[model samples]
Target: MNSKKTSQTEHPPGRSSTPAAWGALAVMASLLAAWIFFESLACGALHAGLTCASWMRGDQLSVGKLTYEGNGIFRANDVEFVFGTTGHRSSWKSERMEIHPLHLVGMLIRGKYQSFRLIRELKVGKSKLLVDRRGAGDGDRGEASLPWSESFMNPANFFPSSIEGGPIDVVVIGDAYRLSLSGLKLLLPDRWAGKVAFDEAQLDMGTWHGTFSHGAAVAGWDGTSLRLENLNLGKETALHEVTLALRDGRADFGIRGTIGKALIRGDGAFGSPGDPNALELTLVGENLQLGPLAELLGQDRRASGTVGQARFTFRGEPDNPLEADSSLRLVANNFRWDGRGWDSLRLAATLTGRKLTVSELSLQQEENILTGKGLVNLTRDWHEALKSPFTAAFSATLDDAGALASLAGPQFATLSGGLAMEGEVRGAENKATGYANLQGVGMKIHGLPVDWMKGNLLFEGDHVVLSHLDAWCGQDNISMEGSVQNSQPHAYKASAQIDVHNLTKRLGQLGIKTATTIGAGAVKCSWQGEGTREAHSGSFQARVTEWISKWTATGMSGSFDGSYAPGQLRLTKAEFLQDELKLSLKLNASARTLEVTDINATRGEKEAPLVQGSIALPLDAMDVWESGDVLRTIDTSGPFAINLALRGIKAEEIEELLGQKVRLTGALEGTISANGSLENPEIHGGLKIGNFVSLAGEAPADLNLTIDAAHGEFKGSLSEAIGQTPLLQMELEAPLRVVKE
Candidate 1:
């Protein structure tokens, strides 16, 4: 070195030495290292600060390295982040992440969040999450970075606590779930006790991905508990005064909230090794709607009703609900389900092991009120409780039994009554035994008014027995017994004893008017029927003695037997008797017509013919007779051949048959022949009366009457004479019309 100094051709100190050359190179390298260090520092610092100030006020993150890629571009790898109020740490590891830092400046002024298309591994709690690419949607999606390195160089950047941001995608995790948010927006409070509101973000799991909401909430953490004031859950629910304490793998929570317009409150504890569901919940509502509440429970209940209140308590394993201990008390008003509805309901029950005990149950529906208490066995699943083996007792009262018209078809529309009943049921699901006794007063069925009706029924499965049934309607009374066995296709038998006093009077009470009354007496009836669910057939018989009619003397008698089906009815036998008068009739009828198979009538001990032969009635005159309108026009389907032997006819009997009270005595003998259709009838009859006796004395006279109809004209002559002397004579004729009206 000393020799070099003297040489005068100096190269600067250490410029030629090997170590000096190294030193110069070191300085240049140092300068380059310093530049890189500052760049990284700026990038990291500005990132954390901007994140906390703009997106999440409490956000903190550590990035492996953020490198600048020119044109305001930046990249990062292996990012670890802590977001929102949760202190839980999550990490993102990837080869590279592209971003344009300066773009965030403009976005920061727009007050919106962007959707992120997550394509790689996102670890949340121990669950591996992958955001569905297609689900991310292409709208409002973008990514930008905070030019941290550039901002670090500018002192102005350090002073900005916050800057409004547009919808920009940033790699940030949700507090509860791992979600890829879209249009995310957050309004964080400056103070720890202030409120925060956010919405229009997407939801994946524990992540904040959802739609827009204007709900506001203030949350505070006091050591072990967190409470939220004024928090909205979804579009229809809001929570108030909610507190949750989570510690040692256990969470204790309480909540007061509203679902739609219904108020709800509950408290519970969950987690740990023992309890699957440990809670006590009470919901008290007045006229609360059921549709929205049902949606919250993931059920479709298209019904109308008000939920009065419900209390539920449970503690046990979820896998074996029968083995769990639970209690429930449900009360509802105007609750409806399955095309039926109830006025009000109250139920209380408790479960212990495999048994469920019902302490109280009361239900009011329509015009009926029912009460029951029972106990039943249950299997592992709670659903089996419905069809399980059990014993139960129930009682019911009907304020207006007719209001339950749907159960009995259209007949109830004309019926009105109330019933009181009590019953006991025992056995398994498919095979059961039950007994019930019912009594009703002021009952009516199909216009048949009854003073009272009482019956007792015993049933074993599908078999039913009507032990005894009694009906009393003023002067009419009936007693019956019946049984129905089997399922859909049932076999049934019934018998009844009826007593009638003053039948015409009873008919009037029922708003019925009949053209004629054949008889009124004790009637015995029985029938055996067998059919499927849709159709039925049965045979019935009625016998009566001592009959009377409005147009005849009091002494009368009759018997009637018939078979009936849905479409047809046949009178097997019908006999009528009034004094010495006797009549028999057999007929078959359909919906529109009646065909008389046989008909014969006679009078006196000699059985002289009064009328004979049958008539085919189309659109029969039965309605005319029922309405007491004898003059009503009628039509017949076929020609008729009939004979009337007017013999042994007394004047008193004739007067009675004609609905008169004339007092006279005589015998008349006649021969009458009739032919042709009812629309154009022909009749030729002759009658002679001798030994006629009046109230005063016997008349020495013989009366002769003749009737003839032919050629569209009718002629009749009446003549009376005393011995050979003529007392009176008369002749009458009338023109006939070919068409009947």
Candidate 2:
């Protein structure tokens, strides 16, 4: 009753909570909770979705185990993926893999306009792969990222597009994927093929797309061959089409291309892929450019213009490839050899079977031209042809020595002027022999000057013979013939005969003093020898006509004739004539000694006999001819004797031999003999003087002097008295000492 009625007040009526609004709130809350729940289950669902998609595509995947974690992370252990059909399948295996499933969903819902972040890690044995979101995006128009692979697939038939280099991008649009790369390098597998790089590269593939290019390309596959077309390799070459096919036991390849402005075409085939190689090829080039080819040939050369044309048809084994028909002609601007450059070269040659013919070959430089032609026969296997005899005929005409020196090496470098040769040569691998007619003008050979030369050269093995040689030595014209046989083994036989017209200044050139060669004369020289250099058993003879070697002795002349056999030599005649004196000698020699048979001298007329003598050296006591002593080797060694017989000699003539002037006029006669060893002789002789007169005293009737050999004493007596009495008598004793005089 009384309860709290005191505060009774009026209360406005409020609308009660409606079921529809409560239901709306409950629906919104349920939506948010369901979204969170679905997000939590995303990893497992994604894995199931992928499995279902793979199954629909008829692809197979084997996984040892699968796992799911928070934040939509899915993982698998031991997973294998297979692509392609049942007949030709490509497979890959992975030890472990991790993927973010939510990221894939985000990419799907964003409709490709927004960037989807992806993070993945895959491991296979020793190789690994990591993917980051930094480089994978919308073509080249957005930020780019690349996946990192730790290892490469074997055979490398396909490669994934990468963006680790300069600002490259990749994107997926519609049913295709595209990649853009700039300044990229791709490795080539061949050792000598080099590498292929590009300034900019682009690829877009839906299924099996094959068209691609840079400067060169493997364009597409047609039937059984790979076709490469429309390639521009710098400014040097342009290729139209190239095809390569390998099938069964045959391989075929061809090229239809252009280099510079030249058109080139070739086709090659290889039959039988076994031990021996067999191939047939036909190559034709028109207006082939030489400028670009010079770099590939050598760096020491430079060239320009074009070779006229070349045709080569070859069908043979590798060892005999040159057995086909081939010809080439070229004109080069600058040709170089041994670091020396020359100007302009024209070359042309043809080969057929074992015959090689050079039609035109010449070099022109510095106002010099060298032209040559040759025909050669190579009739055996390549190596056997080198060792066997080959026939060749060649001729060369040189306009200048410098050009010949360049081609023939340094031996001819010092020579100047021109040379010409015509020869037929036969050769083995290590030796060559030939016959040639050589002619030259204004040449210097071995530092000996010649104005002109002509010779016939004959060669056999290591020997050369110069026959009928006409050359100029100084001002003298010399005609000579010579030959050397067996020169290499050093037991040589040589002979030469020279006829010289003038010998005065020519002798000076041979190192004889001008004063020694005081007169001009003609000389005839002949020599014949057959021996080694160490010991020679030969002889030479020189004869000079009208010889005058001194001014004071006007009529001086000499003649010598000598012969040398095996161990013996004979000087048959040696005579010298000067004024009123005549001397003659004959000598014989053994291996180690010499013997003078007789030495005779006569002054004045033979009838008048102012002085005449016969001198003899008799050594007949010992037999020691093998000793190295001239007297002992040629004759007996002990008890040498000298005998002299003289008549009609004046005292003044005998005083001339003693270097004294005598005023006595006398006719002397003597018979002298000395006998002993050469070092000591016993004298037994006597001299008689008759009708002697001197300016200082009166004439004596006769005087006699006798030498006693046993007593070593001399006795003098006046045979006829002057003024009715014997004028003088004397006895003297003196020891005799003998010495070499």
Candidate 3:
């Protein structure tokens, strides 16, 4: 062969003189040598020891090291693979490789076939896996590759596939318990970072059984320079606690502990690293400790009650302070806050917000329920917070007895009637310097037994004014309007006008039995006074017109002036109860006493038989005195008579009408005393009837006779006088009683 190669080399065939057979022989010789050298390298002992290789016909070539542990089991090391380089052109590489011992055991157990496990620590290098049509014969055929494979040359196809029946489990081990991977380069669509993987990872399933301590060791992903601690996960639980620190745009984390069972999920983003300008955080968990959360925010957790199943989302931008807004909403079945005893009675307000429109707000504690709805604008400035009053029109109804009894301590029991109020408060001050306007406000004080009133009331400048106040008591209707200024704290002034028709019914409703009728009248009266708790004094006057009563006067008209100072009402005139009696009387010791004075009265006809009398009265008789038109007390001595003197009067005419001498003469003093009924009181005195004649048509003689008898007794005999024949009848007695006719 050497001599043939030399001859061919020395005389290369010229293009025109070369024979086709010689050229073919020379080419065949060169091909045989190249094939021999390639076969030697493949079969050599050193080459077999150094190179690990596997191949599939017309498809792939894999090269690595085989580790033989004296028990007939083999493992691959530092594997490199290629697929279809001459035909398909695919390739792959790995830093290390592994084969399972169970594969060899399966071969020993079942002797019919070979069994093996393939394990590998993968480290992919830069490669362009491709498919080319030029590799196929017959004018280039089609190529086939996987969907994700770059081309047919992609060496991932060189990965070992299972035999028709293979070992079930594959075990892999590496330098570390879990081989953490980094610095991987992968090309993916859409500029997304490709997934990274860990190799030969070990899992211990026993850490899921027990409870995690409050502050306990948990599992996490760890790195050389960074660590994420306490990453625990399981079916319904996760204990994945992670804290990330970033400085100057560099952030890192690594595993510090073994992973356990709870699925803890949390995400946070902070800007500016050490000096953040903004922060956003989200957390979701169950049975989270609110105390720790409040402590993280520098708040007192004990001030608020515990909550359940919290999902929190927060975003804050410290850089743009002016345009910042925040909102919070919490839902819980029940929550309570402690009131620090004596401050505000442990109150809670629902649906409070800053710059948010609230549909409803309910405040409740103990037996109180207060609800409101409107817009609220919260501000940091306290003055503005108070002054920026919300426009909330509200109606409140409260149980009067329950509300009052709550504040009244133990003084009273069970009240009735609910108090309802509707009003609007504007520009309310924090220190109570504000006023509210009340419209269509009414209150009914039920169970008050006396009167029920309904009216409009207003509150202004610390005063309460009632307008159109209509109160009804039984059948009487009383309408009143008044204002009470500063009516609280024991200092106030009130004035009202009260009108009532059929005042008798009103008095009866008030449990007063007054035998008088205050026919339709309005008592327009006002009083002003100042006093402390000890005493009160004021003056009032009322014009009483046509005040008729059965016991006193009919159609009486007068004005009564009175001054009241504490328990006394002093009346200046009691004249209307007595008609022209001209007597001063005082109501002392529940009895009427008269100051002594002259009294005159006239009754009956003015011409035929008019009666007049002047009498002195005593105060005692006026006590029980009763009369239709007048009341007076008189002293009546013997014979129930009144003494008087008369002249130029017809005694016989008065006696003829009176049936007797109506006047009596005193026996010892010769004074006339009248003793008769008030209609025709008889006039009596020592006097003689002067006989002239009847003044019918004839002139007559004028004669007079005198009588002398003691003790108002008259002795006279005038049977004949003047020119009459026997005009005087004989009077023969020691004491002659004259009966004039």
lDDT of 3: 0.37
Model 2 residue 494 CA deviation (Å) reads: 6.4
Whichever of 2 and 3 has more TM-score, that candidate is 2
**TM-scores of all models?**
0.55, 0.41, 0.26
Candidate-wise lDDT, in order: 0.62, 0.55, 0.37
Error of 1 at 160 (Å): 22
Candidate with more favorable, higher TM-score: 1 or 3:
1
Count backbone overlaps in model 1.
18
Query: lDDT tens string, model 1, 106-185?
Result: 54454344222111111111111222222121221232325563234332322222122223232334223344433323
Q: How would you encode candidate 3's per-residue C-alpha lDDT over 1-741 as one tens digit per residue?
A: 899999988896665555887889889998888666643443343235323232212334344554443333344444555443344344445544332223444444653543222311122333222322122222221234344433433333322321111111112111111111123232211112222222222222222122221222222211111223443332233334455544333332212221121122456555431132255555544433344444433455543333344444444443222223433333332333332111112112222334434454443433334455554455645346654445554544444334433343434333434444455443333222222222211223323233355556554544455655555545444455544444334344444444444444444444454433223232333344444446666555554444444422334333444455555445453332223212222222112222311222122222321222333222243233232112233322212335433333444434423335334221111235544433333444454444445444443443444344444344554443555544456443363233312
Evaluate model 2: give its lDDT. Answer: 0.55
lDDT per residue as tens, model 2, 1-741: 445454443343565488998899999998988787764465457567656544554556677777765565566777776543333344545565555433555546764443232332221231121112121121221212122221221111111111111121222222233444343333322112323334543444434332224553545432234556766655466678777765544568888988777888999876541213356677888777676655433333334555556666666443244555555566655565554445766777776776777777777667566666666666556555545445556565655665667557776666666667777766655346888887878776645467888889776765667667787755556565655643344565566565565566465444444444245556666767666656566666656555554332243455666767666667777665555655567766554444554556567567443333333344321122212133433333345455666575666656544334667766678777766554455677777776776666676556667776544333333354455667677776666544443
Q: List the candidate numbers ranked by lDDT, top first.
A: 1, 2, 3
TM-score of 1: 0.55
Candidate 2 — number of clashing residue pairs?
3
